[model samples]
Target: MEPLGAGDPIRLGPYRILGVLGAGGMGKVYFGRDNTGRTAAVKVLLPELAHDPHLAQRFLREAHTAQAVTSGGVARVLDARIDGDDSRPWIATEFLSGPTLDDAVRAYGPFGADGVRALAASLAATLSDIHAAGLVHRDLKPPNIVLTATGPRVIDFGIARPEHGMTLTTTGQVPVTPGYGAPEQVLGQRVGPAADVFSLGAVLAYAATGRRTFDGTHVAAVQYEVVHGEPRLDDVPAELRHLISPCLAKDPAHRPTPEQIAGAFAPPQGADRIWRTGPLAKDIARRGAEAARQATLVGREPGSGPSRRRLLRASLAAGAVVAAGGGAGAWWLLREEPRTPVESGLASGAKLLPRSTAQSGKAPKPLWGPLPVAAKPVDGLVPAPLSLRDVVVFAAKDGGLAAHFTRDGKEKWRLPDVTPAAGLHPLTEQLFAAAGTSGALRVHDASTAKLQWELPDADVGRFLTMDDENLYAVTRGGQLLAVDLTMQSIRWTKPLPTYAVRGAGPRAAVAGVTLVLFGDDGAVRAFSTIRGLDMWTIEGQGKSGSAIAPAVVKRKDSNGTSYTVFLGGRTLKALKFPGGNEVWKAGPPQNGTDSWGAPLVHGDTVIATNGTTLAAYDLDGRQLPLNGRAARGPLPATPLVRQGEALWAVEADGRGVSAYSTTDGARLWTWSAESRGPWGMSGAGNRVFLVNDGKLTAMPTVG
Candidate 1:
């Protein structure tokens, strides 16, 4: 170990500086030997930066908050203080004896599943420690992730602090480090643990693959792309792709928390990879030897046919590995033939390659895998962790996103009184419902957790969107219900699609007094939800039961063209509403996987995310950034796009809530995880709410 400098005897805070470890955009970290000659890494804000309020304050806040965390993952805080000198603000932590993640990746190449597991476990443990201290590590990237002799240690708490009183506009400029930062960080919104989880996902990806997620040549361009791009998952390993999606979501509300990320990554399935196995090859050998003994039945025989048979059976039983609830397990029995540890994986049931210690053709490192691409069905995609401040509207299972709340794991309200049972709708807040459930046009008070009123229940919960004025809902039985909230609920019900009620998305919409509904066979019926009269009808375009996008009607063009947008998988189409004529259809929003995150539309730009990337295009089918990598999300929920200081979004990944920027697609923040995203994202108005199969939770954001 090389000492920093000639062991300069410099005194700063509560310790004496002996050498310098490293420096970055934040400040200089020194290898300081305390009065007891104990080496410690003391980080101090650069003199020039110390003069800036945000830099200095954040630096001290990070130290103060980090010091409160007393976890094995955390470097012990020997001593710290904001001394009298204006140019010296520093904190001293015990010197860590490990390689930085950057170094690890450079030295050993990409990490495989084992490395990922170990890294996750260490990080989760660190986040757990930090959370316990009521602090959050706003910037958690690979460079900041360190692998010490003791275990994995998270360093550089320069930006780690309570999520309060912070803004994304630095010097009133947009947030920095676009791709790594979340929307909240971009928008200057208050952040929490979810931000760390998002960062964990990015860092983990970098650890496994040697590339930065939002990597591009230009910083602003990278920022633009990350805030709105998708992950190139075809490059990612299939086994771990599912794990990365949740952490890279655009919505801070949907990204998993550190705990969730940790739990998912450190669980029994792939978690063993995260364990600090000093000698991986030796450990596998030990396990293999035990297996060999079991196959031979030990004392029973030496070179007996029975032993060979058992050994063969044992080898066959090894099969391929799969991800279990929270750990790694065999998915199927491929060749399982006990070859001399030299052959390539017996290409049978292996989900990922078998663990090996050979040189050439060696399986990718444990944590290393291809990047996550668009969503595709993996073993199973679990839910993300939820904070208490997001807004979760209900659909299907109950009603049109009825307002819900929770606290200390208890629901404050779960009322369907807002509207009738509306089929699940995303990217739009307007509520609609179906019959049997409640064909009523239920309007909800998002703030009060109460229903303002319900229109009718005849249409079932079919169409629940708005076009300036009226509300519409249709049932599978071809019954259309509509009501104008501006006026009294005089209610208008129409009947159509008497046969197959297949296609639902992009089905019903209302403009002025015009109502439209599409059927299973692509048939369209245009009528008046306000007056119960037919305007027009036409054939549809997609397969029955395909994801039916909500119908959107816009103003008429010079050619008397009235455009409406509809989505089916990756395809986005524009059609003439009322007239039912195809205008133009763009590509689908997603390709290989499910579009877990919501598809958002803002004016002329239609924004959506695939499994690993976010994309934008004009309604006319033109690419926005046909030039850069995209921000990504297959996280399981719609994101909240708050256009404030910068564009911000919060949504659910399979593992936790996360924040991101909509302006350029930068991830501004994240929270680490110990939970999954099934706890659907919810809440608004000063609080966030989340619910899983078991519990309803509420967390305060503003109040």
Candidate 2:
């Protein structure tokens, strides 16, 4: 792909422009098509970084952080414009084609140990979905992967960052590649996801020894043998050099994880099913049948057939495959028989209220309706609900979200202006997303609330962390994104840790794949949501402005590991995961639990609350004793966990919903009713869901 020059631009928005698919340092790419004949690529920018507006807002934040990731192994992006006072950006994507695993290992000659264990299980599942959509492929060599016939895709994210975010270049320039970098990215230090597992073990030691496990003869002796070398795994293959010698370990905490190289090179049941075969799968199916016969002769501009935007994207992929066969995508929806509660009494306008016990006596009931559906508070707040799939939604403070029908509270579709949302996240039990302290975001249709995509301003970030296919956010300019809520797109965007002057801006959460972020100047950082990078930072931690929010847990006897609990200033800590280290801390201010906002690990106990202290601890800081006084004011807008024998909305007294006991916090039941004041609560599956001050209830789950 190369022609198109004569000063390019035969269209960039709806695509069209034809040849040229290459050029680097963030410029020119082309090879497009669109009007339904699909085939894309695009890129564009470079006119002195598109007339520099700070390098065109870092090239429109590299097309929204390479359009926030969606991996079958990468290369999807699909569309972008940029706009920050006038536009002209470009991005497009989705055209993998073939060649460039360094041109198929310089025309076939090396790969063989089951073809480098199916190319290290397809780039360890594309660096485990580009570090699980946090992104880091900070240039994973071999011309940024490519070899596709439906297999290795990866592609250039240009010098991707965001494990926690920082450096778009300038502080002592160092964007790696000195013989597949890593040794703290050639000593510039701070590169994470173990420097892309040491560039995926030097791209599987250059596909099983064609060489480059740190060779020299140039670039300052390959940056002094990549920080004092030792890599040359002499023709690797000792069972893939025991998985490429811990991904070329040089203490990026002794590498390995791309989910331990996709569980040590998985691929075997029909080895990559049909991802290219023989003569590079007949040279990638004869150049994809001459690029679909040159995209049906440049998509015949004379009488069409399949183009109403490709029949509304094939009827939205056949109505998202018949709304994904109905339900049970599971975020809770369970039931062997529940649906009996509603007892305590009172009727007419409804009132009910009482029911506590459970030190062992048991009482907990009300699984729906202590009654009343709406009469007052729709603006004072009651925003939690959002179960998704089986539909629960709610939000409403006039910003509308509504939905309902988790059995028959009826209603079903509303989705309005979406006021200040800040919740309802989900991302795929048929899609559901929200974010709006005004930076907007939107995305609905969990059964037809319609809308589908928005973005507007999109700087979003007060909190939102999804994962059934991305969503995680953090913007108001801090930027962390990920997004890809089933192609409403974005799968990547990092920038969060900036502080050359302005202060407060840290918080962030996302547990499972790590992604902390502490600050009040007591600092914290962490990061690795599958490779976004930066995996450590403790600093002063004197706890600056702590409203807490850094809980991540997973040590039920450490089989899956993960930790990072946090409280900091008055101390409480945890940390071990993806190596933030600390292990356990505790300290000053225990009883009056230092203000909080993110801690609900459970299983080895961790729970936290700041509606005026609600503690629980025990990952070694002990504490755990609450039988009576715990909930004092604002927590529970979603944090309280446990979910088996009840513990869902942890002690909320004012508009009721208490339930405690995870082995001894007691309280047990309290449902309450007379409307106007609850404002938030969540749990899902067995159910708990609240939203009061304007109705949005649901109950069940009392074990």
Candidate 3:
């Protein structure tokens, strides 16, 4: 291997290697040039990881997803392929030039408020792009943030989770990480995008202050603190307090989502200050802002203050009902609403719960088990927040789309026995989603509370995306269809690629002029919407084995032609839009696989996650700096990016789901999200919708 800093040619997929752009626990990334003389970077997995199929699958997924995504914020993939025999698996991508956030911060302390705000905006926009395409970069941190000449580019997608593909992870294995992990991620609970938001909160906290939120004396202590303790914002400035507070909420449901994060961050800049008061300070401030209230903030000397202290503790415990979780960025959400709700049972039952207390921000010296949470089912939900604009569609335990919303875990709109909850299509701007499971193409319109139309007897696996005009559809039996709007007659029908055995699920994107198709084997067919002509067939070069489903990502480039792509271990392929040219390719090094995610393009960065570790590349395809990372698993769902500064994805192991950030490769947050059980969850809006073994639950992202 050559020095990453030195642009030396090395051996990689159909390309000579160059200097190393960056290095991480997974492997070293080198800046190289492809056979077509196009500049690129090849990611080489570490020798120790080279043989691990889990990491190998993750590697390929990064390539597949990054190549498909075309966004201004993301780096572009040039070429990809796997090396033979003993060679490494490598991914070649366009090179990105910029200074890492780590370098920028070191060169110039903390970024100014305006700079941070700009960075946040860019990252938020980037997140939106990938999220739309359903890709999540599971690791986001400051180091991964790059300040390019054009602007800040978020790069690195090595360990990001993807919507499809499988990773090689051993049974009974535990991942090693730091203080930034969320509670559920640590607990290995069902995870989703919010976990990354939690990581962003940690990264932001570190960026604002020179220290970590839960930097304990030991890794164990730090992990414990991350799951239970309140962070010390003693050094955070006033302007950032509220913005940062929501990210630290204790309950995953309470944390604001990336959208909320961006919205809150987009506004006014507050002065910077260290918070000396405890986590309970906000409660005390609201209850005792006036010195005469004298409950806690105005404690007197010694004996006199003892009673005041007692009152403060009592108040804190009583109000504990409202502690927010990071599923929205856990603990930080605590401040948005008081711990005590207007009519919380916990508030009423505040009589007593054995009185052991600890300092708010300081890590409590461990005695045995987890410190008790102030309340159960944290007050995470926004007070009377509006229901989701899109109605939830789910298959009844037997099979059918069921819609439900909960303000207090109450069902909103539920329609069961609708087959293929995965095949929902929102026809006519109306709410009820349409899809076919076993019977005819069923259209459930929540707006009318009835079935709009049913193309009787035609068993379909899914309904492609739709506008007011036509409904693109695919059946498990290998039939592609275009149904009319206005409940009119069928417009046309065509046979799809035979490889599309599974058929693109209902979530397929079909718009204005394009129809994106997914194949069971890592391939995608982009068709002209109106003509039904196969515009282009895009495929990632993957290893011999059962192939994963495919997806298309939207590339962002003011100048470059839009490209669509997909993922596999160590390989990424990008297809030019309109014409379907093989624009660029990136392959893995020495026995690696492809990237994960459909490959997301945002800003000047192209991201890949969940292959082995979260990784990012500049729009030029160079590897970017990063901090947080994740292991491989089932194809991950696209993440929700907020503030355009970070990307988040859910990490699932046999235990549960956890979220990760792809920007600086940091672990943002986590919650009690579980994998598919008797009753599972679905990915529709930027929230984690769960029906755990028949118990319906919802967790929103904490911005």
Candidate 4:
């Protein structure tokens, strides 16, 4: 860690650079704090190299690669500026407070068998997640692995590329660390997920015995040993030799897969405590606390002076162990900042939402107000609120749609001519698609309410759903249309079945290449997004009066990636997407005639209300207990929403909301409001927005 020298940027994007953590060949990593006081390791490209297109592309690629893997075993990317421009590109990653594997091993001795097994299993799981996202981490070594309170997190994806990508390097440069890189990577050959497995073997061997699997005095000798020479495993334990030796196999094809490594090294129960309970944990905690205290001092004394600079430098130095060991894996202290009102037109990019610290066991007061923002429609159906960045868009009280800042109940903008019945759907973070009174398809900038584009003859009566390429809508004449967003033209239109268009527009959801629709007649249909071709249809999917909302999710199983649609009605069912085949089905509560309402999918759990009881099930149709008594009042047909650790749903009375723990399904608290009939609920930015009888209220979520 060092003081900011001449020519260093004071700020990049939303982050304020406090001090420089370290410098590498391509750029420098800085300790940065955002306006919200969230900390990050902001990596900036060297100004001299910013104009190098190749370096710039690789910098941006690192950001994308790190963001692709969604696992707790990796440092989360907070924000990045990858757009090619005159400004220097930078990436902000959550600062992890921990010592690097190398530092820990140097301070303490080599890990015991239990510790080694735990490390192997955790790293293997992270590798599996990386491979699942179609990437191969080319560098897996001690310095890049951080030991945190939770577990070992793999960091530094600087050279990670697609599984099928060939080894890329500049002239005279090796792409991987000498002792840890696979033989294929050493020979500059094409690599795949197996390459990461080879690196994992080396990492585990080093962890078990403070020695590398392949080592030599010179870099060339180490490379030679990796490609053709036998590994030196004399120091490795006898029981672990067989497992570690196979990983160092000369041929990539002969190496064990990550799953095999994890299963073979299955650590005993309570193995994770190895990191949480040892001296290593104390070291990590001390560094984190000192860094946190210094951050507070710097925040309290924002004035620029020698004393402030010295304090900032000390803070960065205290956290240098994290920066040195984990490279870009360091993160700021995890603490909540004060919630402030949002400025108009500002996008909530990578910003943590303001959360309420209220206990879930008691009712929480409204964060904002039960303002009259929605209109009491003649049909008694209130449109569900939609969140775009910082604003929550809803059906305006007077007419059309209105966008309100989530921080406060202040109205940001409104579109009086936009038809709420036609639907308001976000096209992107900055733009949204809506239907006009004349059935015209229109797109507007979300922040300014400025119209970006429109098609007068699109004849979109109701917006069903949208994807990256097109918007799916329906016409008053019962025709389904796919509007090509890029071309601003109609891609395809097909007449819906006569029974599919009765009452309000068909409830819809998009699953990969398929568009699923639940007709008023309780029938479900799937259509191809490329062309309006019928894929499959299921009859009698819902009960007579049940809301036919279809929840779609993509799940990976033994057969690979497959989309499954969940529906409520005559029975709760999971149907294979596009094919419309029954995957699993569960009957309503035994000995009762109450049918299932719309289902909600969160991770592996699918939740829905059956009569007065709330039930949860795995995707395979196994029931799980909610731990609390079922709702005594009538549960509505709306889908359940998850925020923080609780699942929220419209209460049985149709005028209140209930919170239940997603872990055990125990009812937390109930919020009641006076309302006539239909109620709509949506959650975003750590706040739950509810609309009942034309009144909109914002409530805080448990932190």
Candidate 5:
């Protein structure tokens, strides 16, 4: 929670506001408590918007609608002041002390089948109660459901209305969330309790698989999919799919009622224990304790033994509320920073590259320089550069890992003992993982290069990938080792498949609970992050001599959001995540040879090379057209990198780099160097960093 800012009220009604829990464009939700020691989430309308009749009525209606539902599955309204002109309009509800469903799923990974069933039953019962109150909850998405000590408790009645009312909206705004909303609601037609049932199905799908049932690239496309497309349940477990499918029926009349859904799901006896035990329960208990402490310190004076401000600072320092997730509009007990891929311990995906203003067909000038900071190639291989938030890291020519400012080629800091070959991975935006001498795992601050933590017994050989909880690496003996970050101890170790350890070390990526490793000898393997058990494997994807490094991209298509691994070999293949099942495959161009290199994914397109030609394909593996002049190149076996509209790779001659327009694969510009060495490329913050021989250069991206 943030400290109260200027112009903020100290109290509302009988409650004393302690800190700001969360805020939206319309108002703010304050962490509040009364003299009786009861805590509440007090939502008050913005003073400026209080005079706006439309917003004021909506705010008041939320209070009335929320108060009407008297179920233990919902947050009870403690007090409300909506009728008086002299008072500021506010509604205070019991503060829920737990993460929202969205936050929980994103932080802890998707729930197991039994856990999802428990969630389904709890939410269904809540929806049944809301419908019984002669009202319809128009917004029943993940963020509205909080996983408390008891079970899931539905919160937020901001858009609820009478069951007979038509969907309401101002101007062109849609009344419901895009992917989770029912078709009738998307059409702005009359919605019944069935709308909430449809939303429940979407929520359950996400809870089961950590993916939405319907998704698209933009808001309009998602709404259109909700209206006209079928719900994607391929990723949802087979046994549970049958129960969730019926609730997402396109027609309202075909969807099951909340009571029927509750009966159908019928969680096992003691299923509620899923939320009452394990790490999730521990997190909920921690938050609850923090909330109680905040309540006790609320009315303390400035010079008291321990001030509320100091307690809040202590809470933040203790990582009490680390990250918030879900829709931006959802408010919770305590707001925190949002989790990024680095923070969540997930594989980083393509960021939205900044739009360049340079002419589309013109060659852009260098943004920084061709600085001589890159290390010379070791056995014909240059370490791939890594891009952090503000600095680009490389293996310095003087022998060590060095960080250079992205804005300019100035050196920020260097670690002479760090081994770039051991594989450098970002643990968070501010911290990174690398190996010190003798294969010891070390964590360093990104900006200061200070050693924050180290594990001397890790016996690290090659750093692979990491997630929120553990850092995965391959030991010198070719065994996969998982080190738990929270416990600072080894979690598990498993022997690598014989094929995976025969040649160069494998490249790895983490998606959800699965960690995928692609070996140099064309061996692909998937392991469960929870236990280091083998999940699946595929052999002979490429020739024995070739190196393979597959790229994973999260794409939303007719099959919903798929964490697909794009593997390039004789064929460019898209494999479903976790299972390594081939979704689609495309062979090389009609007359081209069968050899292919590693692939790169940007947005919806996957780009790769076949030694003689560069090709682009959609996530579905359908080959896309490229301009004739730029499509053909004697590209080497290297991974492609993208920045803005340009896709950069080694040019035909292998001594320079060429940038192609991502849209049509037309040649945009080219940069050549005199050095006769391999090229490495990486991009971040709208600038592309290139390493040729031992020279590093940063080039500006053009439209």
Candidate 6:
């Protein structure tokens, strides 16, 4: 590797580029070393190609295709940055030592019979692995084959064709290596694995004879020679000449498959160390050692092995939690940046006013914090208000643990300490429930903070809902479990055909005696609370349900039928309770915002916000008389329902609240407060609570 020139980027993401490996038509490959002590061949697309959407897509396709081929015979793609304007569209792969097949054969002459057989087997195996993954290596020239200590590893998947139907070249452009081009590729016809086999034959013939099978002075001549003419297997080993001849068959169907060639040239005994004592092996070792020293100087110690590196790259790319040692511990690569504490609007030790203060014509001042307690700051948006006697419960967005504080801003109780993994939540106003990491469910009394009952065999509960008598929980596995609080045990548990979609919010409802469960498969299933029998199931268009609980409404019609209203994808539909019939439906906002939070039900009005546009619908699904005025901005948070009005939130851009009349859609009052988006809202009596950023402020309902 040589030093980088003036125009090169010194650092790409976390990896430091040390030098240039080579430059191609689309990009330049660099020698990069990461902080983890991993050396990589980093390929960055040229700036012009990076800006082209089609070319960028092709570049990303190359990275994804290279990443998917997990065989040791192929170099592993370690990282990629393919999106965004500033993105240079780069991919880093394992940096291989030694020379390319073209360079090695040119410098050291043809490989003898033994070496040729080994090369054929290794290359054939690599091709077989690629084909098994439903990919065709469109470019299989000798320069793309790196001869390392391990074997002949194939590289450069920039022109690979995967089964997903993506091709290598753009309109009016052809991707092919001149001398190695197969007849189909030369004619720009439908090329597949057969075309790759033709190229492999040419590459092997060149390696064994130090000459191209079909030679020409120019690309046009080369295409002409490859399409109609053939020759030059004279120097190829006599024993393997027949195998190479079949692979070079002009009619692709007559060409031998990679599996057949690999079977024919099985690795000789002690072939694993084939490159051990050769001059080429010494060169490989020397370069490998130099690269290792370079990696060490850059702070990355060598990782366990290739398998470990592959796992790291994949998990990090998908932002997955790596649970090693058989679920002993989980490592989260996706970490929310620690939020800087927002300035509190509430003064410390502020006095709490009585509920009758509304009559005095003055909005209630903040009683206390942003409640001051020694718990980890809230990271996720707060769920529904958990009423526990005189206090309400608040928890992190994950519902992992919670804190309880009185209306007067005094600390009351907290779940078994303040750790986030506590997973404690309020089951009712009097009982708090927690699902342990071990899938054990434990119930505690709100007043005493003591264990009331325990179900040691319950599945890990993702979210909880309850009524006056029994508690309902939807486990992570999509099982609906109803535990009888009166009986102190699980009454019955039924697994839904499909649970809530992964990454979507959990939605469930306990309306009166009917327990309604919404599946991620866009189906709403209701069961009888008394008998745990399936009451009815209504399937909607396959849209995932929202994170919020369904709004349960009872119509004042002749049948007085109750219904569970759900927000799935962009559509909102009401399913008749017990009977599970579709009653009314509302599609997404057509001309306005696309973002919609959970619909809040106030009086007879069903209010939902898509971005900043607030709409209201009656129990019959008819549009209410809402004079749509834009709130401050889009409210991703669920609207806080008070008395009979919908308090629309504008938390992201503008920090404020607009209380609108749910019946007539009149703007009652608007309160502007400082906040970051993702504000949490809940209300009781005359006080509406707002938790924005790390600060909490109480807004008066009437004001």
TM-score per candidate: 0.38, 0.29, 0.41, 0.53, 0.51, 0.42
Q: Weakest 10 consecutive residues, lDDT, candidate 6?
A: 324-333
How accurate locally, in lDDT, is each candidate? 0.47, 0.58, 0.47, 0.74, 0.73, 0.60
- Scored by lDDT, model 4 comes in at 0.74
Candidate 1 local lDDT, 327-353, one digit each (tens): 001100011111121111111111222
On lDDT, who's better, 1 or 5?
5
Query: How many steric clashes does model 2 contain?
Result: 22
Q: Of models 4 and 6, which has the larger TM-score?
A: 4
lDDT of 2 by residue, 1-703 (tens): 3344577777676667755545555466656677877877666666666777776676556657766777677676777776322355766766655655654553443566777778788787777777777877666776567666767776667567777344235666666666786777666656766788788788888777655777665666776777887888967778788778888777887787887788778767766533466656665565565556555544555455423222222223222211211110110011111122121110111112223334444444555653345324433434456665446676553555666655545665675666533555655435566765577787666656776667776666544465434567666676677655444556577775555101433545666677776654556676676557777777655445432456665454547655555654445567665556676765544355444445676656776653344567777767777543354444432456555555655344455666665665555555555543545677544556676666666665544
Query: How much is 54 displaced in model 6, in angstroms?
Result: 98
* Candidate 1 vs 4: which has more lDDT: 4
Rate residue 91 of model 5 by lDDT. Answer: 83
Candidate 4 lDDT, 76-99, residue by residue in tens: 888888533447888888877777
lDDT of 6 by residue, 76-147 (tens): 778888633457787777777666676455434466667777888888888888988889888787767877
Candidate 3's C-alpha runs over 4 A off are 1-387, 427-432, 436-438, 453-459, 467-469, 497-499, 503-514, 535-570, 589-595, 601-605, 618-622, 631-652, 669-686, 691-695
RMSD of each: 27.4, 24.7, 28.5, 21.1, 18.8, 29.9
The candidate with the higher TM-score, 1 or 2, is 1
Off by over 4 Å in 1: 1-9, 23-27, 45-58, 82-87, 173-178, 267-703
The parts of candidate 4 lying over 4 Å away from their true place are 1-361, 589-594, 627-632
Q: Give the winner by lDDT.
A: 4
